[model samples]
Target: MISVDGLGPTDYERADAARLTRLPQHDLLVMAGARFGDLAPWRHPEYLRAVAGLPEEQALAALFVLGRQVPEGSLPAPLLALLSHAKIVSVGSGLLSADYALVRLEGLTLLAAWRAAGREVGSYAPWVGTDTSTLCRLVAARRTARTALDLGCGTGALAMTAARNGARALAVDINPECLAATTFNAALNGLADRVAVRQADMAALDLGERFDLVISNPPFLPLRRGALGWLAGEGGPDGLDFVWAIVRQLPELLTERGEALVQFASFGDQRGPFCAAQLADELPGLGLSARMLLKPPTPPRWPAFAERDEQGNLAGDLGREYRAYVQSIGATHYHPCVLSLRPGDGGLTIGRYS
Candidate 1:
């Protein structure tokens, strides 16, 4: 649970909601794109210049949203104190820096560890990315459900979002830090009673129960291990490690009328995401029908562990090594997709985002 400057979440929800509202919706999205859109181009000069042009409140909010440091006095004292009490920020030497980032999506306030803040967070810091956003939107669309399961859970945003829709949600994750964050966020949003957390590997999960709804944004990166060798980002030798695991369990995990949504990136050939073919081959055997939403394709990228030179260029023959690896996998394009599944005869429809 989160405390706001000596007050509990209930008090904050009743009295301090306005002061904590970070930024306008449009401004927030732009800031997020600036902060996290390009992983390789880690620094964004144009984004900084753009933030320099917003109104004072928005500009200050941008500093925290982008995980940049500013003078302690620059932000309102009450807001700073509230965030500080929640362990969302740290103040030292009269400067304020973010430990967590606050995001308001679909009328829900969510907290996640700030990746750009350069803080020494746990290996499984809550993932808040495009995939999270996509799943949250899908959760919000479901007005109600008897029960919901969030396989990855991350910040617990998906579970909380489902709880808000009148569903009892069980949030599962292998990372204790992630479970802690989810539990705290559930209380912060006044949904603690409706949400429960458990630590478990989704790859081999069985709880002797089924849910009316299920959702996940599991790790799909093809790297065997990331720079930190974190399991949260690794998808084994093939990117389908977790994807296949989830597919294997869906038949038993979902109720008769249940629905599931999973967002992940997959290697693609000229035809499209490999899921299209995998679904035809495997999902039919499971008696599940699917609708897939795909985004435009991009070239394969080197893993996060690829070494970089002083100028951020690929070090040594790392580029050649990455090319050979991509060739060995026969993956020319990277596809990001959300797959929706339900119990039915094996029918698959694929649509691309414009």
Candidate 2:
């Protein structure tokens, strides 16, 4: 749970992100974008300019809270007290300049209290990720399920969204911090009780419960142990390790004619994201039909990915260990994709976003 602030709703500070675009707080929203530039780069410059344009008092408050660099006494008394109560912005060194703040994801403003990527053992990082927006877009557009399951419920985004759309949601995550965030966000978003968080690994899932819909944005990043590794992000040398295991389990966990919507980095022996081909090979075995909703055109080999990402992901140049590992395993490239699964092997719709 996030530390409580005496001056105001710290819960709001922690989890009101998904609600930002819901209300038209344009000025504050713009400032928020500026404050949270690292996560959403496209809007960075404008937000930075907005912050720079702030009056002295307000600017000091922004600086103090955004990063811990400014002394608490530097800010106006009221703002200082409020910002002081929040815990340390314990993100990776590169991101410590900005404190945990709100970020826009599609239409939802989701919270990211710490760095979004990297996996730590004692604590789980806030997982307001790029693929999560994709998962949200696909899941939110579907007809609401009677009972929805968010298997890797990072912040309970999908489960909470599902509840709002008329489903009783069960959010499960192996990480305690993630479950805490999920349950907290559920209450913060007025989804308390409706969307509950469970602590469980997808591998050990044997709940007698079955659901009409199962959604996940599982960790598909293929990283060697050298980097900041999290057990959650490990998808083996092939990276498809978790994806294959999760889909195999889905066949039994679903209600009759039930459905699933999930997103992942799809790879093939031949390199590049072969999301459709991989699913086509497996879904038939489970007597399941699927619709590959959209495939992002730029695979890992593409120019955009060839550049070192701001997060320092292994996209531009896989580190020596990572490169060696993937090569040894004959794993070439991976791409992002969203797939909708159902009980039959018909109506397999696949398309590009455009």
TM-score of each: 0.78, 0.70
Model 1, total clashes: 0
Q: For model 2, how does the per-residue alpha-carbon lDDT over 166-200 read when each residue is reduced to its tens digit?
A: 89999888776677666556655667768877778
Error of 2 at 15 (Å): 13
Top candidate by TM-score = 1
Backbone clash numbers for all candidates listed: 0, 5
Provide the overall lDDT of each model, using Cα atoms, as 2-decimal numbers: 0.71, 0.59
lDDT of predicted model 2? 0.59
Q: Candidate 1: where is the Cα deviation over 4 Å?
A: 1-18, 22-27, 30-63, 66-86, 91-96, 116-124, 304-306, 309-321
Worst 10 residues of 2 by lDDT: 298-307
Instruction: Name every residue pair that clashes in candidate 2.
Output: 17-109, 18-109, 34-47, 66-99, 289-344
